[model samples]
Target: MPTYPAFRIHQDAQGHHAGIEQLPRPTPAAGEVLIRVGWSGVNYKDALAGTGRGKILRTFPLVGGADAAGVVEQSAHPCYQNGEAVVVTGWGLTHDHDGGFAGYLCCPAEWLVPIPDGLDPRRAGIFGTAGLTAALAVHRMLVNGQEPGLGPILVTGASGGVGAMAVAILARLGFSVSAVSGKPELTDWLRHLGAAEVLPREALAGATRPLEKARWGGAVDNVGGELLAQITRTIAPGGNIAAIGLVGGHELHTTVMPFILRGASLLGCNSVDIPYPLRRTLWNHLASDWQPPDLEALVSETVALEGLPPVFEDMLAGRTHGRVLVAL
Candidate 1:
């Protein structure tokens, strides 16, 4: 069997370690397709899995890319054909199964989303899981009665991949976007990405009131803990908040006053395990009107497989911004 370079995570008596290694190339099994990966992206979960900071991987000795875009090299599944363009997000790519931090990937065909017209593999990978989650969050907010005319939408963690994409998408959809970020230097960048206003992280810091001044008409919250609690309390009546990440903390301390008195809704957004139909719909939207303008601006850096170690370190340390595309 031929061999290929792959980034794998392993554990032993010493400690958990992840690095690039030569591994046998994978072949398509029943209901599977072999993909020649062109691009992948570094997400927060990928950082956790690669660095062994969080128990993100269900198994060891696994590749650690949660998002991949490429061309199909072979297919044992009836739906996929050779040379087809496709992208995969979530679906346990870096958890229980071999992932796309490699030259090739063999995954279930049903997990693949065909790259829609006007979107290439590289751009799709740039969007990747983070972009998908952002789009999903916005979608859920809209479904829950959010609209451009409602009021300004707030996006927390605005400098991160998901938050940045959320801001751009919401702005493109004609919503006034208010972004919150800890990095003061990124204020201009956030506004350039379509944020009507940029607020410091302290805006949501500290203890949150059960209910406060009605501010945001809707919000896409990537930071949990006290930040989420504050957002929930401040949302306008009947507004929705899509809670997407727990980077701050997981424990949500708040009362039901926002829900009972103000009729606020907290919508949990999960990109992982989203059904194929909805995934396709979201991807299609991304490839269409929801696509951010000047996506190249969102890419903070592009690195090769061998460079993933430092990238993961930067992500975990909060030293990186926007999306980091990995060219395989």
Candidate 2:
């Protein structure tokens, strides 16, 4: 019904760029609803998409956030009502569709999950996709029979959004968490997130053997490549490794020794294309028991819609930590 500010990312004849611009209000389609976005969370992928780093955008001139929380502005769907709070993540919001880096977002009702009673919009935005992936990793680990009694659980990239949340959730669920980070300065920060110990990047990178001594019961690895390959080798018998991100590198140089001898399982986590029902369940857990105790501390910054460029640079350069929220 009205025009609003939106941050659109695009690649043109000039080059790739993104900026805040005025956009017409979106109209809800059949089985869809429109949300007046209150808060949107920034992820590494979002940063990449915003800055046109990895061709993250399937189509250009799109809003540049994947996760958002807000109140329903209008609805033609049975599952949602006007003025109701909702959270949206995954379902290809930022890549193929208009995303939350706007004052409003219109999407299928199926993509919207009612913001749980206990959580506020800011809290939901803080957790966002990062918390969802953490929950997925934990859920997969549990389904694979990961147990605290087995040994310590390892979380790689433990100062990042998903890794930090994973450490907190796993530690809360009675597992002893050993977190690894390249930034030795974040050791205390990781400890505050419930890590029993913080290991330097060197500790996780020195495994020359195809199969090293078993140390962790399981691992939630957000950095792929060498770190994931190393985790695959050192996991205890029957341990599962949830390999999530490919920030370090995408290639894995490892033999099948860990899988055959140790029976370690390598599970790939896809937060973007998960089924809607399961995604809703993860959101519920994020609002309940899996919610991070120090969520506020994990939020490194909150920027306005117009202040996204420098944020993107910081993330791509690996200078950012924790979650960054965008107030819409």
Candidate 3:
């Protein structure tokens, strides 16, 4: 058996720890495929899993990466074959199963999506889970009747991975975007990403009202808690809010006014465990018209497997922006 490098997370009497180790390369099982991982991406959930902050892991002593793009090296599944490029995100990766932080990964074939034409492994890693979630959120909003002329779309946590991607995609789709971020330094960057207006994080702060002046046609909120509550109350009639993350907090204090009076809807965006068919549809769209215009600008840094620990720390501290691609 060939020994390959992997980054593993372990929990012991002392506490949780993550580091690189040499392990035997894995082989595909009956319905799985083995891939030589070329690139992986860092996500907030991956940071939580690696740092033992959130209970994101169903099991310890496992490889820790939530998004991977690579080439298939072996396969026992009919849908995939050797030399084919594929990408994997969510589907309990870095949670219940070993994930992409290894030189090689063996995962169920159903979890794999072929890398779209014109997208390389490195570019796929830039999109990873964040881009996928953004695409799904936008898709749901459109299905619920959101359109470019409806009104401006508000994206909370605008400098974060999902928020940044949402801003870019919505702008590309011809919708005006209002981005909210605490970092004033990101104003120019957010604008460059196509945000027509950049608002301070405090713009969503303060007391909550049963209803506020209608502001947005739709919203993509990555921050929960009070911010989400504020967004819900401020949506225009018949608009939708795609709730994606809970980085701010989870408790939602609001009334039925938005739903009953304004006819607003809160669509929970869960990228994990999406039906394979929908996954394919979304990936195809992302590779085409919905793709970010400047992917390299969204990537703040790229690190190797051994450098992931510090990157996770920076992410948890809110010191990092955009995506962090991991080169295996």
Off by over 4 Å in 3: none
In angstroms, the error of model 2 at 116 is: 1.4
| Model 2 / residue 25 / CA error / Å | 0.4
lDDT of 2 by residue, 157-213 (tens): 898899999999998899999999989888888899899999988887678798899
Backbone clashes in each candidate structure, one number apiece? Answer: 0, 0, 0
Superposed on all Cα atoms, the candidates' RMSDs to the truth, in angstroms, are: 1.1, 1.0, 1.0
lDDT of 3 by residue, 1-328 (tens): 7989999999988799888899998778899999999999999988999989989888878899998899999999999989999999999799999889989999999999999886888888899999999999999999999987768999999999999999999999999999999999999999999999999988766647899888899999999988899999899999999999898799999999999998999999999988999999999988898987887889988999978989999999999998899998
lDDT of 1 by residue, 68-161 (tens): 8999999999888899999999987988998889999999998999999979999999899999999999889888889877689999999999
- Show the colliding residue pairs in model 2: none
lDDT ranking, high to low: 3, 1, 2
> Candidate 2 — which residues are off by over 4 angstroms?
none
**lDDT value for model 3:** 0.92
| C-alpha local distance difference test of each model | 0.91, 0.90, 0.92
